[model samples]
Target: MSSEEQDPDYRFTLANERTFLAWIRTALALIAGGIAVVQFVPEFGIPGTRHGLSIVLTAGGGVLAALAVRRWQRVQAAMRRNEELPATRVPMLLGGGIFVVTLIVLVILVIWPPVGQ
Candidate 1:
């Protein structure tokens, strides 16, 4: 093993990597959900709503994936330097973003009319 890997707590480093991977998986799931919603869901009463939701979801997922990379890098660097973990704003930001998206989706669902012949 290199000098870098030999230093610091292996368990903590591995845990951090695991957390990063989990976030990436979450982002992938979000991307898949975006595609699924766009492809599988019927159009809403308002024209273009399905497209809007799909765009929003896909964009959010992309942004989150980028954030995951950034967060992982920052944490890894801090660990190498033996510094305290950086303040974690990513989780709060993600939660707030998803909350807003859910509210918007729920509103759209309520407004959407039934699809019938």
Candidate 2:
């Protein structure tokens, strides 16, 4: 019998699916934030900093979005085959990206407050 033919628990499969959906949601939110930042945020401190943040966040979102799908597939396959799931690095990457973006925004706000607030 093929690996896929080996039936896994229904609950596990459903849980995996839910996790995948959650990741997609995260990606969408990040993309929206990026758009809002670039389009709505006023030009602050450095001229290009605003654009740079938007770009970095959007790119990070894109990377995570792709990895989310891939990770789902990978984990699903491992589950089906009854094999140990591989280590995941996505969480680290995602967290680091968020931290870096937050730092940049904080620095910008501190260094040069947006006037007329």
Candidate 3:
């Protein structure tokens, strides 16, 4: 309707919104994981490691939640403006963050093993 920007197709807009919601869900899961770890996971042999990991997970979730909104807005704007979609580092960020967390968890498990094992 605006001279500068036309509305994008409704389907595309809905798809973008769905993606945003998925990201939000993932973010919530991460934050819950952090809480679950602190509440249920056994303490790491290295002092403070469990707490540190929880903090990292919760913080990453918070950051991703913020970035999801930003990415959604940028994509919506680009679609309306008929501009090339913006490049996003979200995938790499999520992958690398998970990779690092997994590596840390692996190391902890190797060094300390599980309590029952």
Candidate 4:
């Protein structure tokens, strides 16, 4: 086996790939959530607010997917050079932000719904 292949650092690269996949899955879930909000909310004659919220969620998901790909590349490069892994708290922060926003939207949609069909 090649020296690099046998190197312990190569294991980090595998970990990076797994992390990338996890992010992609998260992005997909965000996208699905957005779609669900758009699809189901309107059935109850929800107001424009739901449409706006769905748009935001969809945009956030797309941005997250793009960022995940970029992060994966950076992690791969860092691994190849045996550098310290890049910090990853940003994704977690973004995820939490998304969750909070989604929850708020859901609560608003449920409690003080728009009047008239």
Listed in order, each prediction's TM-score against the native is 0.87, 0.89, 0.93, 0.75
- Ranked by TM-score, the better of candidates 1 and 4 is 1
**Per-residue lDDT of candidate 1, residues 7-113 (tens digit):** 55889879988999999988888889889988998877778887888888888789889989898888888888777788988789889988998888788677776
Which one is best on TM-score?
Answer: 3
TM-score of 2: 0.89
Clashes of 4: 0
For the record, the alpha-carbon RMSD of candidate 3 to the native fold, in angstroms, is 1.6
lDDT of each: 0.82, 0.84, 0.91, 0.76
Weakest 10 consecutive residues of candidate 3 by summed lDDT? 108-117
**Which candidate leads in lDDT?**
3
**Model 3 clash pairs?**
none
When summed lDDT is taken over every stretch of 10 residues in candidate 1, the lowest stretch is 1-10
Off by over 4 Å in 4: 1-10, 42-46, 114-117
Query: Over all chains combined, what TM-score does candidate 3 have?
Result: 0.93
Judged by TM-score relative to the true structure, which candidate is superior, 2 or 4? 2
Q: Per-residue error at 13 for model 2, in Å?
A: 1.0
Residue 94 error, candidate 3, Å: 0.7
Candidate 1: residue 83 Cα off by (Å): 0.7
lDDT of 3 by residue, 1-117 (tens): 579899999999999999999999999999999999899988877768888989988998999999999999999999999999999989998998899889989988898875666
lDDT of 2 by residue, 1-117 (tens): 583556679999999899999998999888888889889998877778778888877887788799999999898888888988878988888888789878878988998866454
Task: Give model 4's TM-score versus the native structure.
Answer: 0.75
